[model samples]
Target: MSKHLPLRDAVLSWLEYAGSLSPKSHSIVMLMLQPHWEDVVMAVAAVAPRDEHPDLYAKVKGDWMLDHRTLLVESGLAEAAQLIAQGVSVPVSDVADSFVTFCTGQARVPERWLLLNATFPQRTRIALGRHTLQTFTADELRQTVPAPALNGLHPWSLDLDLIAGAPFLHVPDPSRTVTRRPTWFDITGPRAEAQHWQALLPLMLWDNELLRVDSVFTVQHGRRFDLHPPAVPTTIRVYPGSQGREEEVEVRDTGEFHVRPIHLSALTAFCTAITKKIDAITAGLTHTRRVPKLRARRLERAGRHVVAAYQRTYDDYGIWEVEADELYLDYVIALEALLISPDDGKDEGIASRIRSRAAALFLTPTERERTEALVRRAYDARSRYVHGDKIKEQSEHEKLEELRALRLLTLQIILRWLVLTPADTGDLAPLLDAAAQGTGREQHIDRPLHAFFATTSPRSRPADIVLT
Candidate 1:
């Protein structure tokens, strides 16, 4: 009975307060994102890994006041942390009305699930984040992230993977190197949903240095530097085929394959938690008006370079997808494209160029410590992997962890760079160089990326825990 009464008022109130700040408050921010839609799903026996705000630990579960406040904050109706602490499945605007009758056709829906109000249709589905697992072939991650969502767009999960017995869209040449067909996480979902799938796409090409600020580099409990035989990645492959075969899948229009993707439960858990923050950051205009407006001016100029980097990171195989060593090198190349300038002195090698410039762009004086050693060690590991030296040292799964850190850092840079400075025609390297010269915490990227790779990072939780 109370669901629809207040949201319209809240938007109006925000507008009224914003009007005092600017004469053209309504025209301020627009998140410009066009999502690359591909089918997405990954599940490990449906582990419901959820996040509980530290605040939630102080209160009881299902507290009405807290849920109301969380909903308000996520919808931008109230001033609060933007992350969704509760895993309530929000509806997408495109399919919101699709379930109206099913929602209210029956009495009160047995108890507490999406209550209907007098203005039910008017307020059907405005918030969108599917609280579940997303699975897809790691290779199908060729598309760009954050499918564009304009004013008031919300989407419900359709779960096309659940479509039973859809015809097999298979690779005709079984010998052409692909052990399995690519099942992509379709960017078909609305903004919030697209952001999640997009972030995960590049991890195959992606580290864990438990970043600590004071030390500049803390030795984590990671053998990430140790050379272990390469892992047969389970992060994105749904069917679990031969090693490196899926990476060989070409990015052609192979039509849609209604197949189960390589589902990495660990990856699903990591991405599920991190994406809430990602959605909050990428929405440009609320510029969470990312209108939620991403500044497209720079994207227009550097679009070629950035998209190519993405292509190399996710689409190119021989360089990135073959082995952990090649994957590391591919990351180096990709990072260089976005951060380096033509003017960068050749005396500074590309790796140092990438490390220093990326630090300028992403790290703070305090945050740099965590990744400082990581970059150095990753380069060392690159040598071992590229040259195929087998170390008898123990395998701590450090290679995978290192990629986790790098991939996440890379993802943040790409997303933030998209919207941060649209009007500037100059290369990102100089501005970041200038920011480095300046002294202020605000000068750093709004959210410090160093913490994401820290051992304390929320993304490192065990995959089996059912937080929800």
Candidate 2:
């Protein structure tokens, strides 16, 4: 066979390039490969060292070639390509050529012979096609892994534990913050500015639905790329309506240009933190604070009903272990805070402000009445129980039960309000779901959500805008 000059030059160039990309020596050669070429390079690299670059044995060990290939094939890129080709107007020749070139020298492998066998001029011709590779969005990335995309591309998968309760994108700038931006500098950070154009062009070319999967593909070339994706943990300010309705008032652009892989634990942690806070806030609103006395037995029985309702709601949202009594105490504290919030001007009274804001945000006539009636009953029952008053008949227990039901109803209402407020900007609903398996929502929710929040910015004093 004719000597593989292109393959040789490409391999040497790639090794030098890969070394430059990392902060440490002995970096993965395939790291330089772009999403379109990642697998092809990995596969070539896996086999190449066995013969081509025996001198580089200390740098790589490759018994795991099959394992890596399985990862790519499992990504479903091959299948996705088949589907797209049916309707794609692009000719197949362009794709075949891209694939051949990618599989050859650009594969980022250290092995020589493996590289030679993999790169074929004929194969390159066969792989050529006009169709561009498939891509995905950050919102569509999920915890559970779905099947891979066609042509060996796969949506990014992460360990769930990495993201559980961990914050997404670290706020303000989702892209790595390189430096502070001056007002004169229209573009903020380096990556942020680059991604605006990077994400924009691909986004315009693809349908919104396609972006949600957020998969990565690699040609044999050493270039990595993000599929069309929006910034993660998209925060939106919403206006909560009574009856658990949230109307999108504004959405904030996270300024995320590329899809960065995150740990599953981070995703979970974020969910847990927000949910726990919600649970804490809701539980606080449910119970009253009167100490038990001579009528303790009667009060305890009423408390059980309240506890059961609280637990039930928690269970629906995958929360347990929050004891009935603790939840009851929280409910009482929240109720008192809500009642006194309008007058609680104390700087440290954050709970009061939250309550006051909630009251102002959503207390339609019907909802207002419901809240008042429940608070009234809880207050009276608490007073009677604490004062050592005589226990009444069955009617009192019935009244307590009514209060429990109303309390649960109110908690749900409050959560809706809490999630919509700009103060709750970290509540990342759409981005969190992106980590979930399966196809995700069609359009990006971040912009609309941010827009929702921006609407209220005008109401704030100009001095408080926090503009940089």
Candidate 3:
């Protein structure tokens, strides 16, 4: 046995160490591991903790060691490692101050679910994914839920009486100018598990033609994001009479938010199919991130990144609130994730790859010149900002426009990618590359992109581009 271990190994060894007992009995919970464990895992893998690789990407917005330090102290691995440095091997996990019982055998994998309250003009009942969406009055809940369950409502429930019309108080606060959004819709029935439920609602939203799921279910409508955006309630209000009015209006709308169920079902299927791949891609971020599961054909590297980037837009690409520079980084990372490959970062042409690929892939031949310039400029600004160089100052409005361009470009690419990425391979990078070099497979790529566009109404296009 080695007298010493690397910091990363020391932590893992401690985490796994069992005292005088069979280690096989105790299983490690993969989910319990810190979220940013990727940097350490990658760094320690195949090489020692002190390695040749600079691991610049590990710095991750300049705080790579933030969690590591806490993990060491909390786990008491720091002391154990010091003892190891003095030549005494420590089974750090055995002597740890804390204990987490790791259970083995079959147990249900609990998913991190997001729930939010939203208002709709019409009280509609539509099946969202595998769940139904509609509001419930107190009486409705009482009748819907078994009497025993309704009687056994959680202690936190505002009202025990579900027979009343309103169980929760909608108390108005006059002290504040902005009151919370009134909850008009409640999604009942067995909630289907979805990682990116945010993406599903916009597919039905007549207004959210863009991929901004946040707008559909804004933070104003209570948000719960363990991993991704909340489930959004969409309004497909058709007539002026249907829209709610201050004066008492006839409740003509009964329960039934009907849509071509195929659209939302398809979106869920698409998101669910890619969930694991997206999880593996995002869980680490760098080359060391977990790879997709076994496949007959090798998955294209760039294609995997493309899907990861698309997922990021809907997931935690900071659709809610992020600083200007941070938002810039988010958008650039997305663009790079879609465009730049692990192999491509070795050279000086990183910006060139981003600029040319983005323009070539998404724009017309005439559009490429300006598009490429725009990407280059945007990428350069990101580079300067990250490297601690302050560039020319712009007004807040000007900065917003720049961010919007990056956002739009990222969203448009994501939508195009949805159709192309039915599988793990068939990267469009090659088609874009060949097209740039005048070997046109224009239709091969454009056909799917256009198909997605055609299936989606012109109204679904982002508000910026849509005429009316």
Best by lDDT: 3
Count of residue pairs whose backbone atoms collide, per candidate: 58, 98, 3
Which lDDT value does model 1 have at 403?
Answer: 62
User: Residue by residue across 1-468, what tens digits does model 3's lDDT show?
Assistant: 132234335345444432222333322333225343453344334332323323211454754422343234323333333444444555444433121111011112222222222233223343433433443454544332111121232333224132122111111222212212322222532222122343232332232222221211111111111111112223344444445743433222112223343444443443443343334333333343222221111223333332333324332223333346555565566566666543454788777877777776554666567668767767777878889897458766676566556655665554444445424434556666676776764465656555545554323453222222
Give a tens-digit lDDT track for model 1, residues 1-468.
244223323333333343233222222131101011000001100111123222111245653222322222222322111111122222233122211211222111111011000111111122223322222222221110011111112232122222112111111121121111121222333222122233333231122212100000000010000101121111232343587443433211212111122323433344444444344433433432221233322222232333233334332121243444555555554455556655666774767655665565544454455545566666666667768885224334554556656655654555444334323233556666665666543444433333334322333322222232
Tell me, by TM-score, which candidate is best: 3
In model 1, which regions exceed 4 Å deviation?
A: 1-322, 362-366, 383-396, 439-468
What 10-residue stretch in candidate 1 is worst by lDDT? Answer: 215-224
- lDDT for model 1 comes to 0.31
What are the clashing pairs of model 3? Answer: 125-256, 125-257, 209-460
Rank list by TM-score: 3, 1, 2
Off by over 4 Å in 2: 1-12, 15-314, 317-322, 329-332, 341-370, 376-408, 411-468
Question: 430-450, model 2: which lDDT tens digit per residue?
Answer: 232331212232233323323
Reference-based TM-score of each model? 0.32, 0.23, 0.43
The CA lDDT of each predicted structure is 0.31, 0.30, 0.39
Name the TM-score of candidate 1: 0.32
